[model samples]
Target: MDDITEINTKENRQLLYKYLIKMYGKEKAKELMFKHKDNLFGNNSLAYSLGKRSIVFYCLYFLQDYFVPKDDNTVRDLAPVHYDIWRELEDIFIHHTHDKQQFILPRGCAKTSIIDMALSCWLHCYRESIYTVVLANRELDAINFVEQTKIALQTPYIKNTFGELVQPRKRTVNKLELELDNDTKIQAYSSGSSVRGTSYTSSKGKNRVTCFIADDYISEADILSDESKEKKYIKWQKEVEEAGDDPVYRNGKLIKSGTKFIVLGTPLAKGDFIDSIKNDPEYKVFHKSVVPFDPDEYFENHTYWQKFKEIFFDNKRENPLQDAKEYYEANKEYMAFETIWEKYSHFELAKKYFNKKLVFMQELMCDVDNVGDSWFKSNRTMPMKEIENHTFIKTMLTIDTAGVKNKDAKRSDYFAFVVGSLADNDFKYVRQAHLRKFKEFDEYIKHVISLLKENEDITHVYIEKNTYNGLDVDAIKSEMVKHSELMKRDITFINEMQRKNKDDKISTIVDAVNNGRIIFCEERVEQSFLDQVMSFAGQRFSLHDDAADCLSEFANRIDEIEIMKNITTIPRGWLF
Candidate 1:
């Protein structure tokens, strides 16, 4: 026997058991090393047996040899996130439960390597008498997945470890199918292919498709065009859903219950096929973005960050590449704390990093509104250079409260408020805005009072009466009375009750923004406000429209406020 085989013998196993007992307690060590004795030490060596337990460990040790050589002849390290996802999928597959899973990772996060290669190898080696179907947007992609799986299976590590268990009956890349010795099969099919009518059958007369994995079902090009998106959605509903639900038969007899469907893709658009499945109650969505740290906290706390962002945008307009380099070099202190800068400090990291602002927000942060079809363009909104220079005729505050009073409710809408000053030219400059799910009514009241106290010029406060029977408005007024000593100044509270539909509210805000009537104060404004405005896609489609709704409430009243100002300014004789 070989040296490795000799080490895995009965004598060596007993010696290792004694060593493990010394290290860990006898019961703990026995549970760890000898729980699956037959599977671990029956035919395969200890290295193969232990490695096979974890997909991440197996890939790192065994599959590293099979990785396609880089330009420098070095293999890339698998990211930590990949390991996390592999373990999650491993648990699901082992339980044999019909559960739907979705992974929303960024591009180049190795969704293909982890799913098509590592997971496939693990499944083929461990699980037997099961069939898996791989689907993609195009036939070529599906074929590629199968090709990669075959390569992974052919690797010396996999061949040596599970040699007898999963011998290949048929392996053809072009055919997009593989048959194993244990009567298990894997097939690849395109999204629009004829998969609904077809059934995968094993040598044991089992004709059940156990697992279905759909990867990159929606392409970037498909998301941009409306017609293509519609067509893809139709194709997904008809073909993809049908194939996932198709019955599994054995020897002309119905055998399996249901297939476990796993959908993996980056969120390229809002209402894509992946998104459709995400909304479905059957699927459990595990959406993860590449955000290294929370940008919201920084943007909210740092006064100069918003101004810095405005400068970055201005510089990007002229030359995105050169300007980013210059900005990074000039503001090294400011950029040093950012996660992107910590990893990629150089300018030539990639051309895409030059457009870091959009890439970071869209790709890493997974800001669906910024990446997909947005109603309001983020670039169109200009920042104020000097708030002091602008002359204000009237200043107003608009508040939109979530109807629910429960502090612990997870799905409760945010309490959003916008403070703006209407200039002499009727152009309303947004001084500041706040949007947050308040924990209590006291907290919400405190924030509102703070905003009013900070901006002494705020003459009118309009609270949208969309809550339970004007109780929220009455509560606010009652709270304001308690803080009258602190308020020190008279502030008129207006209960605006004429509720406009979501479409009208969005349209009103869009018109004001596009027509150059609503200007945002860059220094004082919150990033959440911009995100809400940019992501607002009318009432039905948006994730959160509270911020936009608050802004629109102010916009709708701008004309009325202007007219009231004009009437007050007119002479008494002229009025007579």
Candidate 2:
């Protein structure tokens, strides 16, 4: 039974019809032909009865039956496994390559292998004299496509059919171009230094491409950049759309095969292309595990992969613990994977562990358009609440005016004030706080002083010197003094100099938090203040000296509250 000459000979047609009957049971195959009775036409009634629609069905049915392997070593049999997923992928490639799609996948899936098999099948099985190109982030990865395809073609059935194995040309590195007796050409390329500026069509020609496969097209460099990411994605979209139109003949198929245009890598942060593409509705998304597991309902009751080694590896191997240690030591990347698993696993374990859609949409998949522009780092574990309830005296109130004076800036943290006191052993603790919208410096200062005076613990008032570009501090201080005079209390004003090294300012703040000396009020303390405490790496300090600034000012003005050596315990809840 020959597909190429099934139309040419009546005897050959009979043989092909019998093959189809065996492939799809006679009743089912007959039902399909009967449904397409009007579309079938030819000199031979049975041959003519198989219409265009039936031809497609018959072709697919026969292709599956003739080529797919059923049992173990399916990849070697040159017979396609009748996977519903592979069928859907084929339909998508057949129909939608012209429309650009971005694919997103979790790590350790067989995306690359699937792409390799698809590229080979699309070009070789269909599309005569078609030019096909495969590309990846690097030349080495591109070469792997060629290697994998050669492996696919080396399947026992394919080798038996062709009577020879398809092997890579030794001289032409990073390229595996295969030409059957027909002129169809398959070639691969790495998207590294050699192919960066080179466009595929210019070298391969327009109307010649049957398919273009690109895996991991966007590099890490492009992922990190502002403009480069957009430019690279746009270029890939153009190439795919344009290449999809390059059929060997009109109305012929031009396939672009890959596991979608996956920007494959571990997600580093929020604003990456993988994150961006997962939001797209146009792309048909699928996630299959390189390691398989069951659905969600079934997932919860069992731990398969995690427990596999614990149960089997110890007894299976000579030494189980040593074997586990060796495996863990060999894969350092798994450490990072485990770390992410710990933080994100509660929401993502069902997803990555069991291949389920992450239940939490806001955490797993983010909306691209609604992505945040501003991010604040905060910690609630070692919360500001820890600092909220502490004793303090000789408190100094200090404020750092927001650098910008826009109305919105005024609405934001325009005037950030801290009421801090020097505790025992010279450790300064913040007692009160106020930061909010205000236009007038005197008015803002008045509100701050009024808040402090109500506390009645604050004694010395210190104001940051460089406010409103160093122009308004004097007027601000004078207004504070006038307000005190009206209140009929003589409050001392202290002016503190800013530190030259911002690190020094931060150290002064960190020392207070580290020493458990500063206490915060529950009313104004926040998680962000706590986050600053926890996130103090102590070494790589930058862009976080505001809270430290307030701390430094308090430390500069207040001295230790000295007491008799025998008087060890200070009275609790005493505001001096």
Candidate 3:
């Protein structure tokens, strides 16, 4: 069971025969056992039989020497999971059970090299007059697949084993076509190319496509662009799927069969072509995300793994399949690494890779829903009151001021204030947040003075300086002079100016919120204030950005405030 290569051995064949006998009765098992025995013989027909029966054996044994890494000439075996997937695909191909198959795998899992190139070569060499068409998002990608197929066929190990069987009669890079000595042909086409009337001719004078493989038909750029998504959807339906209409024929006579279509790629968007195909009844979907809901359980109880046990060992379990929802319910703890923490990591990767969250979800988890848009979710926030034990180092007040004559206007920028303590230089616990629209400059000053009186720990008041709403040093100082008796403590008022864009400022707060560096008071902070902060789109200006602006300002200036807290005292004669 450990060594996959052992399945091809003679001793395992006897064991397999007995298992088959127990499952399919004596007569059928004898016929199957004889076929297996015949396939093990050292002959050309035996080689064909082995290749036809097991794709894993064909790749690992027959094509092992040829499929070496270009840089080091080292042969790396496919992962056990990959072999299991290939075997299932082989069964579908040999039995002609499904007309379409969709394979969703991670980025570097070798779906293109193993299945698109090596398996295509095996099919061409083993089957007589087989026709195939390879398609991709771009012309260059299609050409690469065709070139890889040619390279696979021309390898010394393959050429020596099959000799003239795999030799190309005509290999044209311009046309992206490869015609084998056995009259098997493969052509590559881009997604939008005209493939309506395309057909391959066999030695027996039959013309049709036997197989169609589409790799990465959706690109990341296409998913990001709304215009491109619309056009690509139309092209996928009109051109790629319709290309399989090439009629099959046997012995120069028309047949009722058509080409078997296989669409392979990581899902890009929620309702892209891959999603459409999964919803349609025509295609048999085979989706394998790199990180499932429960990573440990997926490795043990996946449907493909169960299928592998059934096919190879004739072992069946009562419960063989577990969907994403069931796995999440059973193993909720394991899901956090992928769904929550990794999403923040993905945000960093998106900055580095210059891609979006859509690409990250699709490539890593095969998740279709776009997640990176909302920088902060409601559940990510923790209540400050929930902290059981913490030392409060310093209390600071950050303000985003708005000016309006009317104190009861509906459509005006809200004056936002955030009073929080820097606890242990790591956590920012918000004690209170005051958010209101259409407050006069005098009333706003009185309100801030009252807050400063109430919160005696507040030593610094950081006000966002702007030309509008009479928010300036002199205006605030004049109001402070009027209420000098209330401000018994020497409060340092800092005129903070933001030099960066609003989006960049919001991103700073996003990192703090995501890393659990900030906490809000459940009772003191208004629900409306939290709602505005959570719902603020980082990219565009929303209807209300006061709460988000205040939080971002606090996050941006917290370090500076810490540096000030280190200063014990200032000379009374020192001028500002």
Residue range 47-66, candidate 2, lDDT tens digits: 32332113233233323333
> Candidates' lDDT values, in order?
0.64, 0.45, 0.64
Q: What is the TM-score (0 to 1) of candidate 3?
A: 0.53
lDDT for 314 (candidate 3) = 15
Clashing pairs in 1: none
Best by TM-score: 3
The TM-score between candidate 2 and the true structure equals 0.41
Q: Which stretches of candidate 3 lie over 4 Å from their true place?
A: 1-43, 66-77, 164-170, 173-175, 192-194, 200-208, 224-230, 246-256, 291-361, 369-375, 378-512, 517-530, 536-576
Model 2 lDDT-worst window of ten: 373-382
Q: Give lDDT tens digits, candidate 1, residues 20-106.
A: 465467996588676645443344654455555455556654565644233655655455676678777756665444457887776
Q: What TM-score does each of the candidates earn? A: 0.52, 0.41, 0.53
Question: Residue by residue across 409-510, what tens digits does model 3's lDDT show?
Answer: 776778899988776635677778888764456677677877887777787788876734334556666766777664466677788555556654675566
Off by over 4 Å in 1: 1-42, 45-53, 66-73, 164-175, 220-238, 244-257, 292-320, 326-362, 369-576
